[model samples]
Target: MTKTFTENDVLKYFYNEVSKLEKEKIEDFLSCNNALTEFYCELLTTEELLEGKLEKPTEKTIQNILDYSNTLCLQN
Candidate 1:
């Protein structure tokens, strides 16, 4: 049976979450479809941009973790 791919499939492909067969299928699909090719490129560019923009835990959060660890360590 022939499987039709969706944008979600493209996302799975982007994240390396798809099987080897699916990956090849999506690669073949993207190469043949201009609109999908553009969309995949956009997804890739957005992923690249988001790499450095992830939010780090706040200082308060870090301190809370440290305090919690200290309490656990003291009890041991």
Candidate 2:
């Protein structure tokens, strides 16, 4: 038996981890469910914003890891 998509599927869908059939079901449900449609729209908007908002690591952090690795290699 196939499982129908529910509001909970929204999170998996947003993460692009839903199966193709499940995605189709989710789309179908969103088309007819007004509350779900609004929620889906908001989720899509948030995903878009998050995609381009990655934070860069500081140079000191990178140097610290490299220094630690060098010390471990010397001890070994």
Best by lDDT: 1
What TM-score quantifies how close candidate 1 is to the native fold? 0.69
Off by over 4 Å in 2: 1-4, 58-76
| Runs off by more than 4 Å, candidate 1 | 1-4
lDDT, residue 25, model 2: 81
lDDT (Cα, tens digit) per residue for candidate 2, span 6-70: 66787788778888987888877778789878888898898899989999999999999999999
Best by TM-score: 1
Q: Candidate 1, residues 4-75: lDDT per residue as tens digits? A: 778888988999999998899999888888888888999989989989898888999999999999999999
User: Relative to the true structure, how large is the alpha-carbon lDDT of every model?
Assistant: 0.90, 0.84
